[model samples]
Target: MTMTTDMTNSTAPVKPGTLFGIPVGELGWFASLLMGTAVGFAAFFAATFVGIISIMAINTIGHHAIDYSLAYKRIGLPIGLLVIAVAYAYLATLWTKRILRKA
Candidate 1:
């Protein structure tokens, strides 16, 4: 037995738009870039903050156990910030898509 599917009937149509003379398909790329920039900025700041704290703790405390604890503490903030930024970017993308759907 042979089965056939209608490939020609399975494709959806594309919508068109222009932003400052750029095509709508390019908007998805633009949105991705913007999200990446935001996340990168968040990570940069988080890492800077964590690094400064870790340095100060190591200089002042100067104990092996305390150093390990401080290291973990210093890492915690950046990890949390990265998680939040990723979630925010995901939601932002969904929101953008929803808004675009209505247009």
Candidate 2:
């Protein structure tokens, strides 16, 4: 026998997932980190592409002149870390407020 419970008319409020006993709620820090990773990856690829193109054009195909570290280390990593931190902080505050209001 198989039985399924319908959730359409349920009146209970769904609680968001938590982390470290703190209610991260929706758009949690981990999710933000994942998003930041995606953003950072995109940034790194775009920056590398542009830098490589610029070096090829300006340096007249100087095969050994391009520095790849600038894109991922200096730009992309920092941006990703910043986004992760900022998003986590912002979401924490926002969710805290929303939860408090509901309480």
**Top-TM-score candidate index:** 2
Off by over 4 Å in 1: 1-27, 63-103
Using lDDT, give the best candidate's number. 2
- The global Cα lDDT (0 to 1) of model 2 is 0.61
Indicate the TM-score of model 1. 0.36
lDDT of 1 by residue, 48-97 (tens): 57766776777778853344444345665666567657745664565577
Using all chains and alpha carbons, the TM-scores for the candidates as numbered come to 0.36, 0.46
lDDT of 2 by residue, 1-103 (tens): 9999876975655465555554546564566556546655666566657665665675565556556566566655666566656765666676677668779
lDDT of each: 0.59, 0.61
